[model samples]
Target: MQYINPQLDIEQLGRAFQRDGRLLIRDFFEPAVVEALSRAVDEIDWALTYRDVNGDRVLSGEQLRSLSAEQRAMLVDGINLVASQEFQFSFCTDSLVAAAKRGESHLLARFMRWMADEEFLASIRRITGVTDINRVYAQATMYTRGNFLVVHDDHVDAENRRLAYVINLTRNWRADWGGLLHFTGPQGDVLESYFPHFNSLSLFRVPQQHFVSYVPPFAQGERTAITGWLIAA
Candidate 1:
């Protein structure tokens, strides 16, 4: 199946990427392919992903519901405290990376398999001009009201991350709704921000200072995306 829209001008996209460190291509995916991908996202179980004073945390729905009132309150307090002063976030995530690693035959796993294939990676290479990207790691994300991600440079040296990407699946996301991907300057000023365009593909170099802006209570719907990195190992 052709997941990518054949109408894309890849050469133009490459020029944009070279001129800037990042680029967002709208209507990047084929409509039929996007429908299937969206359906898969709707069906997958998502674990609550967040950060607290204890660091990264992933709580399944069942596990969260099982916590005693006081335990749950404590967890909330811990996350809030960390959010007040340091890096923190809360969202839903399911890893395609894990599925593929385990040899799963599910649709998401097959999608990951296709992504790691040369046919897909070659297109990414053509755009980014980073030929060593031999593999990919992807995860589904759902950012709802009050969920957020604080700024962080994707600089972990051991991860072999070359470029980061987000395949935005949320339809009709407004800029004012605030689930935007924001890039900041060294002085912490907003350099550029991108709305989550439906069926769009966003690509940015690694080690970039960026974050998903907070989704406020007034936002209408959840922001969904397939996010990951091109690996060079």
Candidate 2:
């Protein structure tokens, strides 16, 4: 499915980014493309993992199986712990094109390739006003009950990341169910919050304080999204 938005207003998008260092584009992907991407996300296998207080993956898959039931329960209920299901993929500058050349046919891989395409990168550059992007690091994240990420600035000098993007795939999310993307000011107060609206795209300048609020225990559905960073060459 083609995901490009030919009618995107580059000037307006740039102005929004310039104003707040962030922009939320509603109905960013076409309905058909969003449907296809959502189905593809549902079909993938995700690893159950635990993230530490620093938001780093601490335990995953078989490692969790090693823990006793009581220990596992304690870890899940502990403060500063984040439990989630996710799959991450990284593409070098030319890996996407190389994968296509080798006849790679996975739906999610193809979607990533589309995102890594020069045309798509150019479009993102126009929107964010970051022109050095040459690599795309993408992940499929699933946040269920009790999952959360603490506030942090995504700053890794080696990655040279310019923009952070999250393409929300879940629908019918409620404010009470949580999983909102909250951005905080310098004083640690919430400056803005965004829902995981279906087919919407959220982009922000890197090294900004932000986080995904915890998914409430009563949330009946999973909060899923394709999230990634656009990095310089």
Candidate 3:
């Protein structure tokens, strides 16, 4: 499916980005494209991983194999050891680039490939004025009840990340349901919060402090999104 933006003007978008350091574009993708992407997300298998309070991955396939039976049980039962911050469930198709190199083809893979296309990158450059962007990185994330990510500036100078993006796919989400993206000021006070609205794209400049609030136990549905960074070559 083709990416369509019927009403957006690149110059206007760039002006807004310069004024605020961030932008929220609703209906960023065509309705049909969003539907297909949402279905693809539902069909993928997600691996659950734990992150410590400092936002470091503490448990995974290899790590689990090294733990004793009792340690494994504690992890499986969701018992927080001294280091854990929260649980994370996600599917990262990091092999898409490699598959493209080998001439592999699939609907989802092709869609992901388009994300790194020069045309797409050029469009982003016009909107954000980040002329150096030459690569795209992405992963699907599912934030179920109790999952969260703490505040941090997504800085990795070596990666040359220019913009962070999230494509929300969860419909009918309420503000009180949690999982909101909260941005903070340099003094640690909340500057703004964005609800996880379906088919909306949220973009922020690099080095911005932000966090995804916890999904509460009483939330009615899962919060799912495709998140990634636009990077320099």
TM-score, cand. 3? 0.82
- Ten residues in sequence with the least summed lDDT for candidate 1: 72-81
Model 2 lDDT tens row, 1-233: 45766677889988898888899998888788889989988865555644445553435445656889898678765533233333221111112344455668977778787888887788888888788898887777778777777677788867798889989999888888878899999999999998889988999999899988877779998888888799887
TM-scores vs. true structure, each candidate: 0.94, 0.83, 0.82
Better of 1 and 2 by TM-score: 1
Candidate 3 regions off by >4 Å? 52-73, 76-104
Root-mean-square deviation per candidate: 1.6, 5.4, 4.2
Clashing pairs in 3: none
Worst 10 residues of 2 by lDDT: 87-96
lDDT of 2 at 38: 92
The number of the candidate with the highest TM-score is 1
Q: Name the better of 1 and 2 by lDDT.
A: 1
lDDT of 3 at 184: 97
lDDT (0 to 1) per candidate: 0.88, 0.75, 0.75
- Top candidate on lDDT is 1
